[model samples]
Target: MIIGLYFWNLLRNQQSNKTAVDRESKKEMEKLRKLRSIQLTQPLAEKTRPQSMKDIIGQKEGLKALKAALCGPNPQHVLIYGPPGVGKTAAARVVLEQAKQHASSPFLQDAKFVEIDATTARFDERGIADPLIGSVHDPIYQGAGALGVAGVPQPKQGAVTKAHGGVLFIDEIGELHPVQMNKLLKVLEDRKVFLESSYYHEEDTNIPRYIHDIFQNGLPADFRLVGATTRTPDEIPPAIRSRCMEIYFKPLLPDEIAEIAQSAIAKLGMPESPEAVRVVVNYASNGREAVNMIQLAAGLAITEGRDRLRAEDIEWVVNSSQISPRPQKKVPKEQKIGYINGLAVHGPNIGTLLEIEVTSMSAEKPGAGKLTITGAVDEEEMGGGARTLRRKSMARSSVENVCTVLRQIGLNPFHYDIHLNFPGGVPIDGPSAGIAIACAITSSIRRVPVHPRLAMTGEVSIHGRVKPVGGVVAKVEAALQAGVEKVLIPRDNWQEMFAGLQGIEVIPVDTVEEVICHAFPEWAESISERGESEGNWIDPSIEPAVQPILPFMQARSTSE
Candidate 1:
C-alpha cells in the first residue's frame, strides 16, 4: 500500500508540471497576439500629394469643374479629354487636395478615395473581383482559420469594402472591357454586395465547426466614382458613356500659359526671363508642348551652369526642338518682253481675243526710248498667231530695227523710257505684244505725246502677224480703269463685242498693219489719208482720230 501511494503521488506531480508548461505557452501566445495587433495599427506608406491648387497647371477648366463638384450638392462624373501632357491626370489629383482643404462637411470625412488605373486593374480578373467583391477563403485568412479553435468559416474583405463610403477614381477608364464595365454598373446600381456562403458543415464538428454566414454581409457601397481618360466617351461602351459626364479639355490660353510658366519657375528653382518665357511659349507647337520644352530647357540650363535663360539659349533649344518656318523666295525681275493682257483681240471668225498691253519702253522720262532685250523665246507658247515672227537675240537689235523702220517713214520716235506690265502676273511668252510695245516706245522716244485716252491691245507675231486675241471685254475694262477712252481690239473680236461694250470705242483691226497705221496717223499719213480718201469706209459714226503731238516742234525738244 505504501509503494502504491508513492507511485500515485509521482504521477500527480508529473501531471501538474505538464499543466504549468501549457499555461506558460498560452501566456506567450497571448503576448504575441497583442504585439501583432499593435504592429498592424501603423499607417500605410505615404504618397506624394500636390502642394497647392495653383501649383497644379495646364488644366484650369478641369480644376474649375472639380471645385464646383465639391462645392455643389451634386457631384458630376468628370471626363477630361485632350492629347497627352495636357494634364488630364494631374487635375483630378488636385481636385482631391482642394476638396480636402476647402470643401465644407467635406466628402473626405466619409468618402473614401480609391484610385485604380483602368488600363491595368479593370482587365485583371483576379484584381477585379478581388477588389470589388470580397474573396472567398483567401489564403491570407487561412492562418486565422487554423488559429480559431472553433473552426469558424469566414469571408475575406476586398478593397471595394475598404473604399466603402468613398470615391473611386479610375484613370484611363475608356480601356475597361465590356464585362468589367458591366460589373461596375452593377455595383453602382445595387449600392451593396450580398455574399452568400456556408462557412462549414455541421459534420466537421457536432458543435458546428463553421458559421453558416461568413462574409461581411449587407455592407453599403456609398462610394462615388470619378474616372479620367484621354479617349472620347464615344469610344467607350455606350452604357458606360450614358452613365458618366464628359467635359472636353481645351488648350490653355497665353495668360494661363504664363501662369504655368511662372509656377514651374518658382517650383523648380530655375531662373527665367520674360522674353525667354515668351520665346518658349510662342516657339512651342502647343501649350503643353511648350511647357514640356520649357521644363527641359530649364533643367538643361541648371546642368549647364547658367542662371538666367538667355535669348540665345531659348532660340537654340527652339531651333533644335521645333520646326522653322519656310523662307519666302524672291521674285525674278520683270523683263521688257511681249505680254498679253485679257484685252488683246484676235480676228473675228478665229474667236481669239486677248487684251494685250504693249510696253513700248520703260517710262523713265515719261517717253518711249530704245530698248535692250535678251532671253530665249518659248516657241510652243506662240500658237498659230504668226509662225514667221523671228525671235530676236538682243533688245538692242530689235530696238534698232524698229527705229530704222520708223526713220524710213520720217517719224522720229525717240528719247523715252518704256515699260510693259501685264494685268495678271502671267509671263508674256509670245511676240504678240512686240509691235504694241514698239509703238508705245516710239511715241515716248519721239517726245511726241500719244493720246492719253487711247489704249492698244494687239499681239505682234515674230513675223508681224498681228494675231487676234481673246477676252477683249476684260482688257477694255482694264483700259477703262486706267482712264482710256478708245480700245483697239482685233477686228475679228468687234462683232463679238456684247451690247454692254458702249463705254469704250472698240476699234477693230484685221492685221498688225492696221494697228500701226491707226496708232501713228502722223507717221503713216498715206494710210490715214486713204481712210479719209475712202469717205464711206471711214465711218462718220467713228470718233475723229486724235492728233495730239508734243507742243514743241523741234525734233529734239529743249527739255530733251
Candidate 2:
C-alpha cells in the first residue's frame, strides 16, 4: 500500500510539472499577442509605395524599358540609373510581378525578392560573415552547438542564395566593395555561389549530409540582379555595365512632384490647399521628398488646429527642414547691358541657369587694368594616384580664353577694368560658360543689350568659335524651365533630338559672330548696314553702358 502511494505522488508531480510548463508557454504567447496588438499607423511614404507599374509616375520611357527588359521568359539583368525618389526601386519590384506572370517564365509563385543595401550591408572580410555573398561558418563559431565540438563548418545563405529562382536587388550598387562586387559577378556568371571554409571537408563522415552536398555543389543563385544607383552611367564600372541592360529615369519635374504630393495627401486623408501642394513641389526636389514634406506639414496643421494645410505651413516646414527650392532664374523684363544667361547642368541630369553679369570701368592706369571675378572658382585640386595637382579653375581658364577672343574680335580688353560676376552662386562645372562670358564682356564694351530671354551654352575658342559641350539636353531643359525663349548651342553639337522641343528655340551657332547677331540683333543690323567685317572693335561711335555717378553724389551732398 505504501509503494502504491509513492507511485501516486510521482504521477501527481509529473502532471503538476507539465501544467506549469503549459501555463508558462500560454503566458508567453499572451504577452506576444499583446505586443503585436500595439501598432501605429503606416507612414505616408510606406503607404504610398507603388504597388504596380501603373502607380509609378514621372518615368514613361523608363517604365517602358523596364518592361521590355524584365517581362520576358529570358529576363535580362538590369541597372537603373536615376536620382533618389524617382521610382527606380518601385519599378524594379513591380516589373518582377509582371515577369512572373508570363507563361514561359521559370519563376515560381513562391519565388522571393531579396534586397541588400550596399551602403549598409555588414560583412566580415575573413569569410566569417557576408550578407551579400554566402559565408561558411567555421566549427569554432558560437552558434555551431555540438557541430562546433565536432569541428564541422556551417554554410549560411546570403541574399544571392536566398534570391535563387527570383530577383536580387542591390540598392546603391556603386557603393559595393570591390571584392564583394567581384564575388557577385562570379555568381552571376556561374548561376551559383561556392562557399568555402578552412574547416570544411567534402568527405567527412562527421558532417551532415546537407553540409557534404553543399560542399560538393555550390548553392543555387540563378536569379536576375537589378541594381539601382544615383550615379551617372560613367561612374559605374564598365564590366557590370556590359552585363546589364541600362535604363535611365529622368528627374521628377514640378508637375510630377505635385501629383505625388496630392496622392500622399489623399492617402493620409488630410486636407491641403492648392497652394500648399504647389509649395511642396516648389521646395521638394522629388517624389519621396514631396511626401515627407506633406506629412510634416500635415502634422503641423493638426497641431495648430487648422482644418487644412496652408502654404505658410509648408514654408515653415521647408525652412525648419532647411529645404531649398530648385534654383530658378526668371527671364527679366528689362534688358540690361553686360547681363547674359548661361545654361549649366547639376549632377547627372538636372539643369540650372547661371546669370553672368559684367561691369567695366576705365583703368586707373592705362593698360594696367584689373579683371576681378566674383563667384567664379579660381583654383581646384585634381586627384589621382598618390598625388594632388593644383589646377586653375575651368572657369578661370574660360575667362582667359574670353580675353583672347576679345583680341581676336578687335576689342582691347586691357583698356577696361572688368568685374565679371556669376550672380546667385550658380554652379558651373566646366568651360561651358565661355560663350556667356564672351557675350557679357562684349555687351559691356559695346553697350549692346542682350536679349532678356536668351540662354546659351558652349565653349568659346580664342578664334571666336563656339565648341560643343556636354549635357545639352539637361541644359536645354533648364532653359525651358526658366521660360527662356531662345537657346544657343554649338552647331556641331546640334542633333535631331532637340528638334521637337517646344516652348524654346534652340539655335546652333558656329562662331561668336552668329552669337552676336542673334543676341544683339538690333546692333548687328546697324553694323551690317554700315558693311563692316563681323569682327571689329566696338564702333568708337557707340557709348559704353556706364553712366556717371555724379548726379547721385551731388544729391547726397545736398541732402547732407
Global lDDT scores for all candidate models: 0.52, 0.84
**What CA RMSD would you report for each candidate?**
24.0, 8.3
Name the best candidate (by TM-score).
2
Query: Which residue segments of model 2 deviate by more than 4 Å?
Result: 1-28, 72-74, 102-111, 232-235, 270-272, 303-307, 319-322, 364-367, 530-560
Query: Positional deviation of 339 in candidate 1, in angstroms?
Result: 28
lDDT, candidate 2, 208-292, per-residue tens? 9988888789898999999999988777888899999998788888888899999988887876578999888778888999989
Count the clashes in each prediction: 45, 0
Candidate 1 residue spans exceeding 4 A from truth: 1-50, 56-61, 97-111, 122-134, 137-159, 194-219, 282-291, 311-560
CA displacement after TM-score superposition, residue 122 of candidate 2 (Å): 1.7
Enumerate residue pairs that collide in model 2: none
